[model samples]
Target chain A: MAKQFKSLHPTKFYRDYLNHDIRPDGRLISKFRPVIINIGSIATADGSALVRIGKTTVICGIKAELCPPKSERPNEGFLICNVDLPPLCSSKFRPGPPSDLAQITTRFLADLILNSACIDLKDLCIVKEKLVWCLYADIICLDHDGCIIDACLLVLLTALKTVRLPGVEYDAAIDKKTINEDEQKSLSIYNTPVSTTYAMFEDKVITDPTAEEEEISSGLLTIVVKNKELCSIHKPGGSPLSEEKLYDCISETINHADLLITLINTAVAEQND
Target chain B: MEGKQRSNVKFVFLKCGVVSQAKGSAYFEVDNTKLIVSVYDPREIPKKTDYSSKGELFCIFKYAPFSCPNRRAHQPDADEKQHSAIVKRALESAVCRHEFPNFQVDVYILVLENDGSALSGAITAAGIALAQAGIPMYDTITAATLAIQGTTKLLDPTLEEETLCTVATHKSDTEIDYDSHGIIVLAMLSTHEQISEFYQLGNLDLETLNESVNILMNAAKDIVPLVEKCLVDYVTKTLKSNAES
Candidate 1:
């Protein structure tokens, strides 16, 4: 009987739970899914992390390669971030090409990482205008659940924290270099930015909505926080909320970000070097 | 040398022999999956101030707007970019880079239709295109793909089979018991039996993966004769046209 009503009137079913100040998953409206983080599992990658928020699982692997720095930015290296949502993750995605959602998430994450100054590009430079390190950070979604942005954000940050840069001996005149992997240095992260996603359907707002809830929602907002400061408020145009409500979401996300940072730092420290 | 500052980048031919910089081009078709590849001449590495002792190869893989069910963007997406990287890696070992120092060769692959095994197909077609362009190569390259669901290994999976290996369908009433399913693509040098690139996705145990590699190699070998025959035909046709002209 409950399944019939849920399949027939999904919005009404969710509304019933929301009115009762609880969610169908036995959590409060402001509650979030449990996050499980694992770091440095992929040995091939310089840094790697797998994060799970509820059923949404995302793995981020960072591979470092050497290339000449761009002429305009000779002192800085490159950071290329790509998110792949393959058919293995879910049936909604196909095998041939990346879906629209995959592209959008990738672009959004790249933008956020840049704006937040999470990792300074200058740190990746090996030699000015001659040789530099290019970090290819690839985030693959293994399972499609709800609130993937939060998981992707956490996993990316965690992966970045685990990165170790190798020492290189450079000959600027000949433009050749030899790597010394024995002398490794960890990355210096500038900021730890974490995000929280909220779905607003009608007037009621729910935090860390599931995939089903996201569909029923008319508006979705993601708030990114760096420490106590709000870094980004990404609302890709859904129902607009009042200023008071937006402030409330930001406050909640700031608190959530603090909690996530502590958890991530502990996980990083626990990982074997 | 006496002229004003000129653009270093060359915009070669538009058509095969016309005003294009590309030296060689080839079109490949396998069932509904069709693609075209063009190889450009070795040129100075553009916008690179540093010197390279050996040449570099850059590949771009893209699909047409209507190639698949959904509309593709003009810019290459993550999958296409990754495909380009794999193709580059597969072809990198085959090419003799010492011949073209401080230069770069650009290979462009455009898939007109996507049936299945597009990446493997792109590798095979790119190899042919490189050869047709008179690029230095160690040996001919070939590739194949395999789809595994449980114990059933489907060689050269169609689009539907590929999807099946990707993820179980939502419409299926019963739960899929056996969790093993995956697709593997292997690119190899058929003459020397050297595998250049191997890519896999899905949840398959190591045992299944080991068996799947053998199956893919066999399938790749089966296609070698066709590729050789196609190249022989291309050479003969060109020779005949030269005689006539």
Candidate 2:
């Protein structure tokens, strides 16, 4: 009987559960799924991470290259982020170029890296106006269930935290740089930010919705928190919510930030060990 | 890295149906190199410029940005495009194209790590994925690579070994850099006993090339049993699940 109703009137079915203060997946209104992380799986990459939350999985690989610095920001470096949602991951994605959702998430991730002070750009400079490290962080979705941004954000953070740059020496007289591939150095991370996605189902706002729930939901609200403080909020377009409901989402994300940080730390530490 | 294993293929790990969305998918890992091959169902040809009696096959080969020693761009480069063509040619003869006329099947290979012989790995994985997709095929396909230097033939060489065998080292006085060394990749249908594709790099005498081709054929044939075992396992698992449900 339940399965028949679920397939017939999916929205009405979800509404029935919401009225009973329950979710189809049995998660509470503010409950979040557990995160599983594996670091440095790609041996060729400077850094790599595979993160899974429920059925959604995302892998991030960071490639570091040397390039000439911009004239205006000579000491600053670059963190170019891109997201690929191939047809292998989900049927919604096509085989052509990056879709709008991918482009939007890529830009949103780049913005979070810059605004959250995750890493200082000056640390990547080898010489003033000469050479700087450009990190190409590519995030690929291997599985698409729902709430992909949260998994991608954690993957980006974990991959960046595990990056190790090689020893580099610049010669002013020769105008060339020599890199010692063996002598490795690690990056200094400033702050680690965590993200959580919540969906507005009619009047009820549920956190960490599955792909099915997201389909029935009206809109999505992503909350990014670092050190128990709000770092960024990405609410592209959604139903209007009063101040109290919005604060509820932020507070839930902030409470979960510590758990995410610990997960990342343990995963990275395992690789070192 | 020594003994009889040195001249034979390296240790490999393979899994099927890794990508849930694709009709068929396989992941192949040889030591440090890892790749994923996905095949989609036959669909209408994108442009459809002309009428044809047979179906079309499209292959795309890509190396992840962090997969190689050098940082790769997002777009496909010249080498990757060539590899894409090579892979398509390797799998062309095995498929029964007349079954799905005018439609097109797409195969995508992404190398997560390019330790060595990435092209050969892609070809082998592509064949397995195609079979898993239930595409009509005449026979099972397998591919192997051999690196030749003088009289030495190394099967499935590593990246360092491949470069050393292919790239010509500059001499102090000699003008000719072409040496008796090169790398060869061969794809063959195991049951049909026919070679589908052959790709060679560097310079080698006809005698050496002939000798290496024979060696690669045997190496490629040896892989047939393992691929069959994998496919058998897949069928057994599916049967078991279906029976339970």
Worst ten in a row by lDDT for model 1 chain B: B6-15
Model 1: what TM-score?
Answer: 0.55
Give the range where candidate 2 chain A is weakest over 10 consecutive residues by summed lDDT.
A86-95
Taken over the whole model, the C-alpha lDDT of each candidate is: 0.78, 0.87
Candidate 1 lDDT (Cα, 0 to 1):
0.78
Q: lDDT tens string, model 1, B22-132?
A: 466666666666566767777678689987788999787876543564544546689888898999999998888888988988877766557777888888888887887
Model 2, A78-167: lDDT tens digits are 888898876667657776688998999998998998999989989998888888998899998876788989999999989998999998
Poorly placed runs, candidate 1 (over 4 Å): B1-245
Q: Which window of 10 residues has the lowest lDDT sum in candidate 2 chain B?
A: B1-10
Colliding residue pairs in candidate 1: B12-B19, B12-B20, B12-B21, B13-B19, B13-B20, B13-B21
After superposition, which runs of candidate 2 have C-alpha atoms over 4 Å from their true positions? A1-34, A203-206, A210-216, B1-6, B49-51, B168-178
- Best prediction by DockQ: 2
